[model samples]
Target: MGQPVLLSLLVLLAVAQGVVLAYWAIRDRRFRSAHRAARHLHSADTHAGRLALVGEIAGSIAHEISQPLSAILTNADAAENLLGEPDPPLDEIRRMLADIRRDDLRANDIVRHLHSLLKRRELQTTMLDLNEVAATALSLIQPVARKRLVTVRSCLDPMLPPVRGDAIHLEQVLLNLMMNAMDAMASNTANGAAERILDVTTDRYDKYSAAITVTDTGPGIAAAYRPRIFDSFFSTKQEGMGLGLAIARTIVHAHGGKIWQEGTSAGGAAFKFTIPLQAA
Candidate 1:
């Protein structure tokens, strides 16, 4: 009887020890993962990286701004030339003045977007209309899309309830995603793809949340790269810093949202993100 009791006790003790070892191993793995994540976030949120991103689209923005300025100059010249005429053509000059003012406002809107994007401030949360936010982001991306020969379209839901989020950060998310889609399509277009189109759609996900999706008619992500698409420092592009999707994920998560890639039915790529609606 004593020998049997001793054998049972030894077996129980060994099992307890095994369980303790497994728990510690799991904790250690979690801690290491968290540490690595912190490091990646720190590295990705640098001023230089932001500036580099801005630089990537700076030419397109400059062209956009210059178009309005040139239009204003042409209108101004016409107004001046009319003022020197015998009759002065008051009605014609008035129309030219209106055109000049409209052009100025257009340029101002672009600059405002730049100012908001370039402003270095803490994340601010407020009630935001997702449609307005989407419109602003699409406006900024339109110039680059046009230049790249990509047809950009949006189907924003007018009834999307307000979501509490940081406008600048959310816009950053949209810009990053759109620009990424453009980059992906650029290479595919170079490879003899017939047409490149980007579609932005927003809708109410459910009673508690709203969703936005950006889809591109480009070669979809490879099977091997799908899993790590949002992982920091894991990029398919040779020169990519591999932080855009990661940063976007962090921002979306911070705003009580989830971001993920929704594989397209055909041979394209689509990404969708959802944010909870603001509490009444």
Candidate 2:
């Protein structure tokens, strides 16, 4: 009887050990599968982002090139008319040629900028002036703001120190923030009031970092949605793919910065980010 009892206890112990081992094996497999899936999804998302940026640049180039091309055609026609006459005006022809050269240069610059922005290669980091980048971004989007009746107020601190970052990525970050703010205001304008306003400011918070704030006088984000606002595919806008803020945050983080949103004093949302100041 004693031998039978011992044998039963040993069998029970072996079965328990087998069960534990099986559980661990299953858990390990699950973790590996989850990690692989996450990486695949991230890769797909990155590819999609690059494609979308390409589309945007193509559209902008089409519009930008159209203006200069039209000007070149007009100038060419004017020059031809002058030559068709018995005596062509040499000064007018020279002026027309100068205009054509200027337009060609403008077109070349646009293409170069687009190529730099759309490059899929790694970032080239260097010391960058926040005020200059902010101004350039605002200039690019001012037309959109004006069309939506949004007023932009810039308060850039000239004394701020430069930061180390990729110029193109930094510009994209600022442009995305401004466009998001403009979109938020436009939504409000469509529903009720058209009092749209955006405030973009840059200041040095301390010796260590510089801050950039994009504030909008639109409806503030709900408390429930605030936490997930930076999450991918979690946009509040109808047409938003929910990737802009996510991509912006990633870029800021890559530059050793942090991006976040908070309530503004004027009853709206404020997106603020900070980057470490470069050693002077």
- Top candidate on TM-score is 1
Tens digits of per-residue lDDT for model 1, 59-178? 999999999899999999989999999889999899999999999999999998887777665557899998888999999999899899899999999888899998878888888899
Give the Å error, residue 252, model 2. Answer: 0.9
What is the number of backbone collisions in each predicted candidate, taken in the order shown? Answer: 0, 0
lDDT of each: 0.86, 0.80
Candidates in order, TM-scores: namely 0.82, 0.73
Q: Which parts of model 1 are misplaced by more than 4 Å?
A: 1-49, 190-194
For all predictions, the C-alpha RMSD in Å is: 8.9, 7.4
lDDT of 2 by residue, 1-280 (tens): 6999999999999999999999999999999999888756644554456456546446545776788889999999999999999989999999999999999887777666667656654556888998988886776566557666788899999989889887777777887888788778766755455468899999996778999999998888899999999998899988789998898887788778999999976778999999889983
